[model samples]
Target: MGTIELLMQGFAVALSPESIMFALIGAILGTLIGALPGLGPANGVAILIPLAFSLGLSPTSSLILLTSVYAGAMYGGRISSILLNIPGDEPAMMTCLDGYPMALKGKAAEALATSAIASFIGSFIATIGLVILAPILAKFALKFGPAEYFALFALAFATLGGITGKNQFKTLIAAALGLMIATVGIDISSGVQRFTYNSLHLFEGIDFLIAIVGLFAISELFFFLEQHAGDGLKKVALNKLKLTAKDILFVMPASLRGALLGFVSGVLPGAGASLGSFVSYTLEKKVSDKGTFGKGDPRGVAAPEAGNNGAASGALVPMLTLGVPGSGTTAVLLAMLISLNVNPGPMLFQQSPDLVWGVIAALFVGNLVLLLLNIPMVGVFVKLLSIPPKYLMPIVTLIASVGIFSITGSAIDLYFMVGFGIMGYVLRKVEIPLVPVILGMLLGPEMEKNLRHALVLSDGDWTVLWSSGLSIGLWAVAAAGLILPMVFGSILRGKMKRSKDGLVD
Candidate 1:
């Protein structure tokens, strides 16, 4: 059968009453889980895996439900980022850079609405891409070896100076500190502990989720206590609650660009939504910023939202086509599929066309459901800003505390979280950007592992790093990333200033 006929049959299955019902339930549940700080999509899907089995859901029905949740969680992650400056997940961290700034500027409603639209656009496009390009992208992703992966990570780190557009020295310090922290665990290549301090808890190294919660959520709590400020907690303006046509038009190009970048990133195993978001925000800041990107520009909110959601959808490509999970959440989904005896690979399309295409169709449906569900709730989410700090701070603390403890069940991790929170507070006090620290922590280990693996494979020949055309291209991009920022940073700022002053068109 042709692709269109298979897709149409899959839609027939996905549109069944039972499938639609499961999709709705999954979408709502996933959104709630995602809105809670720290409990991201992976946990959400994992939590429901047992339930699917207990209920004896068919393979198609269970897959549809879980995949819907995955999509919904991606959409919901922006909520905490925009309202509270706490990312609901790692991928949402970039959203907090500008989304919270928009909230502080009393444009919280606009930011939320704009993000919802951009997310829809991104997921819609990525789902279409998945439908058309899954096999081809899977094959392309196989071309990335250890050297290419290392260079890709290098490109990510090289972009940080431009992403933050802050003090390069301070950013380097923060990133270095993160890399140092990542080295605390036992070395995979050597099995020797580096900085565990003879403690059992440190053996596994710091969990990035715990670090993220502490750094963003707990630190924000400290800031709240210090300021005790309720001045910015006014009710959202109803007049600005809805998105204008100009606002839609203004963010459309950035969203499109971000979605494309995010989809490509997601296609590559290990690149994931975090990189998609980081790259999208960095590129948008370069391409379209008028000095307002990190200061609450709607494009800033739109770009990352689109990027992350696009990556979320695109991550399924490798999972379904090659049986290689592209992101962490998809890893969990992979295990679930294995448990259900559904072997995903090139043969999955031919052997279980009904199950495979049903899930894809459900993803398309779930995107629509999320878009419809999120837009009407913007006013509700914006009301979070009106809550006084005295009452709200404790709730934030409680949520972060509970979420972390529930995930790790380790008191030491909680203490570590508090320590990281203090560290984050102190870093912010010195005018240091926190995103680079998180970025380093996220990518440092992978970068090191890939570099080591490449060296081992090449028998310590360093030239292997640049031998492949892909690796060489990535190296060139990394070099350009480091150099172009320094060259264009001042020029862009100058142009933005002139534009603001009516001296430039």
Candidate 2:
């Protein structure tokens, strides 16, 4: 079938009454949570995962809601940034520089309108990119052998340093710590308990969800408690709601460039939406003569919104093609797929055409929904800011705890969650990146499984690691992923020094 025909078939599935309902619910909830500070796509997914499970949501339905939530959250993040000067997450930080400035100038409605339109453009562009690129990538992925798979994992692991905080060494150490934690259960291949300490519960190994909840969800709660002392909350005005034609014209080029930049960045393993936004912002500044970029330049609002939305879609590329996530949020989605027994990778398109196509089709529909939802409901969403923190935080905390507790009904899980929350708080304070820990936990088991399988097949022949050209190429990529960052950084630094000297002269 032609691409258009196939997409139409997929849309038929997405637009069904049930799917549409769930999509709308997902979008609404996603926007609600994402607009709140400290609650981002990753955390929002984690918090709601248990609820999704409890509802016995179908895998497709569940994913539609979750992914819609992801898309919606990306749209809603700008709401917080533009109005309160507080980013809903790291990715939205750049949006705040221009978004808030627009709001301060009583252009809140225009700022939101531009952001919404930019989000639609980015999402639509990325969805089209996915439709065209995903199949090709998946076709090539079918050629990968076990060695190549092992090398791909290694490359993803090596790239962790680039995404983490200033202390790359510490990030590596934290990642190693997570891997070690993964070893606590009985080894599946050898049937030997590696680090269980003889506990029956440990025999099954630490649950990935539990660990993630502790590391991120719990950590965030503690951080919230600390920041609770601050008085930064501000009400957003909802009087104006239109973007001028000139405003649209001004931001069009930047949004397109940002979408492309964001997609490329998101396709790289470990570089999440935050990096995409940062790159797009820098690119726009370099290309445009706008002095108000960080001061509410409409392009500033458009660029990051476009970049983040495109990055969100682009991150799906690696997950669908390689079964590896390019970011923490994708890692969570990957876990969701596994839990549903839906194995991703090149074979996925063939194995689950309905799911894959449905997801792709839903992206297009979801973007349209967000565009409609964002513009008309601007007042309602803005009103959400009025719900006082005293009331809001408690409800959020209660909902999160209740949702998580519903998953396994294990009080112990709750304890682990709180522990991780405290750990997350400390990690945030120390500026140790939490994402690497989650990424490590998610990939550690897969990496080990692939490595052991390859080793067994090779019968102790270490040289078999490089037996395939694909494996060698992957190893090369892995090596470059590690080394190229330093080379690039040095080059950029030298150019900066030269520019400074020229300015002085």
Candidate 3:
């Protein structure tokens, strides 16, 4: 069938009563989770995966719900960034540069409204891009051989440093740790234990879901506990909603530019939404500023929101097309798909066209839902800002604990989760990036398998890894990924820190 007809059928599936209901639920839940400080979309999605499974939703329905949550979380992230000068997630960090300033100047309503509009526009543009680009990319990925696949995985690892732009060494360390973790369990080729240490639990390898919850959700709990002392949110007054059409018109060009830039960033492996938001804000600040860009410019609020949201949509391109995630949240979602026995990649469209198109159509629907929901519900989310960690942490803990336990019913898994949580907390304390580790865990085995397969095909000829044009090109990109970050990381980090200095409290 043609892409258009497939999309029409996808809409039919997405618009089903059950799909719509779950989409709504995901949208609402995701926003609330994103509005909460430090939870982000990755954690929001991780914490809810068990819920989706326990509820017995079909794979398509579960994906629809989760993808809706992903979109909503992207929208919701701007809330704390604007009102509290505390980003709900890393991608939202850029929003705080001007969003909090606008809020401080009694333009909170305008900032929120502008960001919501920009987010919708960005996501809408990205969804269109996904509709156009994903299939083409998937078809291209069909040309990939084992060597090319190995090179692609290397490219993912090489570029992962862009997510943090802090320290490539630390990122590599985290990724190495994850790869080591991935080595646990029996080796598929040898059918012999590699790192199980004679334990049956380790025989199956560390469950990525357990690791995801531990690293993102459980560790977040520990971090909150450690940092919660004397950390209080100051209330911001929400002035009357007075966003004029002229105001919207003023930011349109910036929003469009940011969204396009953001989508490109999102499509690149490992660059993700953080890069999208950072570059969008930086570019908009340079080209359009009349010396009012950072002080309280609505365009400042709009640009990053557009950029990050666009990136969120763009990140799905690699995940759906190549089975390689473009961002941390998508990594978690990738794990969810694996857990559900649905492999995502080039064949996914041919094998599960209904699921792929349904997700795309649902994204379109979810964006509309978020636009409508965010505007009227701004006050509610603002109230959520005042909620204490004391009351909130337990619920996150409860949900995570219950969800993980429900999945395996294994006490050993729970103990391992706690161990991983402690490890995550320590890693965060040392300022090592976590996303790369997750990416490594998700991609390591696949990387190893591809490498071994390629070697065997060439009779153990290591040079075969770069024999093909496609493989060579991928290797070149991988080299650029590793080298560019070292050259540019400091400049980007400096710019981000300077922008963050605008925080009032």
Error of 3 at 41 (Å): 1.5
The lDDT per prediction is 0.78, 0.79, 0.89
Candidate 3, residues 1-505, lDDT tens digits: the string is: 7889999999999999998898899998899889987889988998888788777789999999999899989999999999888899988998998898898899999999999999999999999999999999999999999999999988888988876555889999999998998999999999999888898888989998888888888898887788884445665678899999999999999899999999999999878899999999999999999999778899998999999999999999999999988988898899999889898899999999999999999999989989999999989877877777877887888888888888899988888888888888999899997888888888899999999999999999999999999999999999999999899888888877877876666
* lDDT, candidate 2, 173-248, per-residue tens: 7777778877878888889998778977678887767767667666666666676644536665665566678879
What TM-score against the true fold does each predicted structure earn? 0.61, 0.92, 0.97
Show the lowest summed lDDT stretch of 10 residues, model 2.
Answer: 496-505
Per-residue lDDT for 271-370 in model 1, tens only? 6787788779889999998888778899988998999899999889977876656676775676567657787666788789999888888888888888
RMSD of each: 8.2, 3.8, 1.4
Q: Candidate 1 lDDT (Cα, whole model)?
A: 0.78
- Clash pairs of candidate 1? none
Output the worst ten-in-a-row residue range by lDDT, candidate 3: 228-237
Runs off by more than 4 Å, candidate 2: 1-5, 229-232, 290-292, 486-505
After superposition, the stretches of candidate 1 with alpha carbons farther than 4 Å from their true spots are 1-119, 130-135, 162-169, 236-363, 493-505
The TM-score of candidate 2 is: 0.92
